[model samples]
Target: MESAETNTVSQDPKKQASYNTVETMEEVNDSPVEEVRLTVAITDDPTLPCLTFRTWVLGVISCAALAFLNQFFVYRQNALSVSSVSAQILVLPLGKLMAATLPTKAITIPGTKWSFTMNPGPFNLKEHCLITIFANAGVTGVYAVNIITIVKAFYHRRIDPVAAMLLTHSTQLLGYGWAGIFRKFLVDSPYMWWPANLVQVSLFRALHEVEVRPKGGLTRLQFFTAVSVSSFCYYIIPNYLFPSITALSFVCWIWKDSVTAQQIGGGIRGLGLGSIALDWSTIAAFVGSPLATPGFAILNMLVGFILIVYVVVPIAYWNNFYNAKRFPIVSSHVFDATGAPYNTSLILTGKSFEFNREGYDSYSKVNLSIFFVLIYGLSFAVLASTVSHVALFHGRTIWQQTKASFNDKFGDVHTRLMRKNYEAVPQWWFHGLLMVVLAVSMLACEGFGRQLQLPYWGVALAMALAFVFTLPVGVIAATTNQPAGLNVISEMIIGYMYPGKPLANVVFKTYGTISMSQAITFLSDFKLGHYMKIPPKSMFLVQLVGTVITSLVSFGTAWWLLTSIDYICDQSRLPPGSPWTCPGDDVFYSASIIWGVVGPLRMFGKLGLYPGMNYFFLFGLAAPLPVWYFARKYPDRKWISCINVPIILSGTMGMPVAKAVNSVSWFTVGIIFNWVVYRRFKAWWARHNYILSAGLDVGVAFMGTLCYFALQYYNIAGPSWWGLNIDDHCPLAKCPTAPGIQVGQCPVH
Candidate 1:
């Protein structure tokens, strides 16, 4: 699990030489002499600050102050007054000050006496990429937006802050620990090729290889001075003063105006109608491209949103969509005029809106077409993953070769940095135990715990069923969602089939096999890093720390600064619309009820198995098999990477506008910092690129803290017309008071 490179770097040549001589001499004199070896030599490097009591105290105090300030000045402002701006913008700039002031040591080039550290901060490139991707769509993806919201909504009274915090830290530690146990399978194996790590390493190496050495002390001071000033400016500028995005939407608007833009625009309208049909494969191809411009996938999603906002609700206009007394959106349920919701409709809306609050809600119902498309994607995922796994790894040949190769090259040194497979539970047993605990917790924590309660046997059955079902689907979602938003349909199935048991449903559906799929995927990536000879233990520890921090900090901030009803009502009205709605969940629930009931009824009223959307997902699930088959058949072909079509297709649904100042800003950070590192320490960077990439991530994250506030905390409102105050009474027509639209304007042309 550790890298041989680290062992080599950490080894003390003089001490090791001395010990080797002593041991050799003793052995020469006495054939059976038992001897010890010296591993390192202690030396005082003034800049290599000790991690002593004082450091710990200072670190803790500073972090606590930072945390409290963030919570009070930043988080509280948004939570209380619903502000349009915040101070986190100010806070992130200070990170630059910290980064510059913190002195770091430089390692001497093999024959020289100089050293360097790239940047200071808690995150780095490899760290950020893995952390963000995971948080967004990897194993821990579900833990992001919705999970936190649901927990807060459902179990506010039961959730002790202390317990929640403890649980979070505990789960995180456990995740890290579990990763350690599987490090051999996941990290050191050459075939794993964690491409993300490679990317990080590349960035790091590139930065250092490009460093320009200073001629003298004055030049060195100037270099330092330049770095300090440039970095500070980089850290603060885009975050506070600039507006993110100059509107990339225009690129699609002008060039692809006819088909791509018009088609996508039509798709957005279709979304409002609740049925989206598009060629998944084609969309996948388009999205896989780096920019992911306004292509087919965007077209499909846009149509879905449009149909809902412009058509569906407008037709229901005679019915008051807002006033509980007149035109409540749900016909089956009743509510108090004050907007407090209850009953089946309330349950549906609450759950739906939770997904909404998490950013999955849409104004329209999904037509049968999207439902089938979802099913097809799901089916393809299952088939593709299974066949891929089988073809690539039958009888552990790949695994064995990887292990042998690593052991032959750098295994001994790695053994010291990363522990060997230690005493830990196997994957199956650990998950099995997890299921047991989850079931118990669900029963106790949920409102439905007391009612419609299945017997213990039923609980067992649910867990078993969830485990079995989550495998193919979870893998599909991972592969597909990695590049696109196809998981919405899969989620729909879970919502409707298990309706009312969102807690159990979400936990089971998301956690188990999903975890397995991600483990495999990331393990593959790690293998890539291993092949490239990046230090394994360094990669492992840095990633572990970064993931834990992002989860705790990012999730917490996202939860606290969540949008309110007004925000939702207003945001939903925007022309393009809010990302906060759960159209997928709505589609799933509606399909589940429609199919679960209708399909069975048509087939003679058999209950417990709806299988309608499941079949569609199964198609999606099977779609990948052929592509994978061809991949195996032509393994050497360059297009093999296209197997990630589904992911590319689904992921671009929400690529933060590249033109956004923030987006442009981060890329700027990457460009500038890499240039600096390249100019100052090119050789060292080439050698230790992984760590350097991590350093960049830290720097970027330090900078991002500002934008997070400026964008997320204060200015949560949509464009004015997008807010709730719409002019529904236009003389020519009337508009509904739902999210997204100004009264006088006809919905988008």
Candidate 2:
């Protein structure tokens, strides 16, 4: 998309600039631009009246039909392909379908012609969000985060959906606010590529190209028809006959079982020693950290294999087995430190375990404790970097850039490309507003989610403290995802402050802490988007809608999925350590107890908070020092320490196992597909490929909906359909008491 014409040589640097020359009078006259804005471009008016009833109905039906067709055709064309073309295949055809059938207007695209626009259909952010929310409810209803779900279900727990929405939305709002301040560096800078948005932009470009081109017309229709038919088949077949068909997960299963060898087995028997080596927590850490990115697979593999089997499991058994000569297995009669039956009859009943378990009684206390320590240390390090970065480098620059940006956007078009020179929101006002928002939300959450059981004052105090503590931490997470978001440490503080109220701790962590943290993160992303020429106001509204929708939908789906799992426990192809089954709650609990007791002790005593052998503290202080010193010393070296070392190290080490398998699989399929299309037909592939991919994603998604109903909801035999035994996968307590064996006896080696 680069401009073909080159700038002529000029003696003056200012005059020699390309795209700077004004149009000649004759040329300007020759170009009859139909619609133009003096300062900012407008794509139709924002205040266009809503469509009439007839039009609305027609639009909705068209959208549904299109959505179905898109999913069906998209997956049939090698659904597992990971190439940009595959993504385009999913976006283009859908666009073409809309263009061919819907009403349109001409719109100008950068570096291209004034293209015909298709109806965006009846879909808006609201509908997008709502659909996701319902999907989430379906997921959640069937599969709760086992322990947390069990606790809530048993307690007849009900969280206010509205309150959850408010908390998450507010956090996102804050993130946007903060992101606005850093718009210059994150958005305007060409080097700061948001890799995630690459997909969206590419899809848009590919789709737009085809929609505008006359040659793309027939292919587009084919795509639309394919997706429509596939969706219907998927929906009907799954609902009536099969149900388990989410295209995304289907690939994952194939990758996991047929392609990859990683598996989690049930009941006392580990997957060899390797089985004991992996768990959900470690999986999350590996996936989310830089360790799972490209170029880091080998390191992750070595680290993951070593840490899980050797370090973690051994350490877990240290106090119980190494010290007491006890084994990994615990007895049903054994009462853990809390005085509750560690493996009680309460859990033995499948009916009871499905409904009742409260908090975490799964992992050894030591494992939990380590998790607590790690999260706390990470938080401290994050806080340190945020303060150091802001105070030493960013403070003055932020103010100047913000003012310039404001003027550029509204004052002068000339200032558009230049750094935004605007003042940041005053710190006091910014923080004060955050506190006020937190306060209102905290009260509302407590009132709505009775399960939180938080005393009003305590809830307010915990949130206020969390907000205050998280500001610096949040800043670190905003700029770098490797943030110590005070998750573990914050839990500790809440645990102590609230004292004995686990559910309250849960609410605070989920809503109170995550909300504020996400707020900063979302805002940063927006700032990044702004630099890429996306409209700020639209971005804001879209995010608000997306967050609200995702929250409700994700949560709801989580619930539904949990219920469905319960309904068909055996038939599910889900792994034992799936997020639906084994969630991140363990980390939450460990952090709460570890910090709740010890963090406060450090304050009163001579020792500081987290005093002894504080590797995290050392890491925090040392981590940035080297980077800062290096950056200062070598100014001419280009970017250095801005890439957080720990994050870099983790990412570099962890990429292969998490990503390589998927990447390789998709690549293999893509190469074959590309060859087949290019060689088999004399027709050009580039023009039609994008529309084809779009058709695929829609088709897949449509099939996914069908799979959801068939496998998950409408199965005739439920868990018994495939003769899969829940007893094999279900936790020990939930399984029937073993024949000829005492309930409390440990398994023999």
lDDT of each: 0.32, 0.35
State the TM-score for model 2. 0.52
Encode model 1's per-residue lDDT on 305-370: one tens digit a residue.
234334533353324322211212222111222222222232233422222211212222212222
Give the per-residue Cα lDDT of candidate 1 at 196. 33
**Highest-scoring model, lDDT:** 2
RMSD of each: 13.7, 12.6
**TM-score, each model?**
0.48, 0.52
Compare the candidates by TM-score and give the number of the best one. 2
lDDT tens per residue, model 2, 272-313: 222211111112222331211121222322343344333543
Kindly report which residue stretches of model 1 are placed more than 4 angstroms away from their true locations once superposed.
1-145, 148-184, 199-246, 251-497, 500-504, 513-700, 707-744, 747-749
